[model samples]
Target: MSKHQLKAVYVISVAAELAGMHPQTLRIYERRGLVSPARTQGGNRRYSDDDIELLRRISELTDEGMNLEGIRRVMQLEDENVQLRRELEQAREIALHAIREAERAGARGGGGGDLVPLKQAVAVFGQRPSIFDRD
Candidate 1:
């Protein structure tokens, strides 16, 4: 199957129809600061796929007995967690790639030295006295 295009924006009515909600409900969500729709030159609101998905999430949270304020806080925390996870994953990938690149460069330099174990990279930077040091 082809990948879906998420770049398109729907008008308030169309978005409401797609989300199984009324246009006024969408406006209420905007008023609650739950979803921010884009504005056209004529100042009409346009809801993107992401906005619709957020609306659905807000609806689900509300259905689950969460107040609007609680939903807002939950959504904020979820967004932050997702961002942090992405950053951590990216950092891990970069570290792994750097290790591979360094190994390749070392192999080409004709050092013929044994490859250091992954655990030793931290020690290579020098032993800073740690408060938790047992030794």
Candidate 2:
């Protein structure tokens, strides 16, 4: 986890105040699997900035008339979407880097020996030409 993800300094009361929620509500949310705060050695819950933002998001979703289960599913999908976007970005970067390397190799008089050749073909979609209409 990153430093921001692990930094949990705010106690429950302070976290609730920051999130504009009651302490008990935070407990309820925790039980519902909405927000998970860190814990101290004494088993005291400690909220991170990420947790605070998540609480705020939960509040917003609650106000939007979504049930707890629906909110959980929505948050799960959103997390998946974020992960997919990150993977896509990484793939794009790798492809671009490969293309640049190929261009540099070609510019340096390399015969493109590292590359594989493929055949190309074209097709006319709508109607066959008269040249192909011979019976």
Alpha-carbon TM-score of each model against the true structure: 0.68, 0.79
**Residue range with the least summed lDDT across 10 consecutive positions in model 1:** 1-10
How many clashing pairs does model 1 include? 0
How well does candidate 1 match the true structure in TM-score terms? Answer: 0.68
What's the residue-level lDDT of 101 in candidate 1?
79
- Candidates' C-alpha lDDT: 0.80, 0.89
lDDT per residue as tens, model 1, 1-135: 112223536999999988888999999888988887887668888788887788888888888999989999999999999999999999999999987877887878946554765432233356674534554
User: Where is model 2 more than 4 Å wrong at Cα?
Assistant: 1-6, 113-135
User: Tens-digit lDDT track for model 2 on 1-135?
Assistant: 557436999999999999999999999999998988888778999999899999999899999999999999999999999999999999999999998988888888788445776554455778665454544
Candidate 2: pairs in clash = none
Best by TM-score: 2
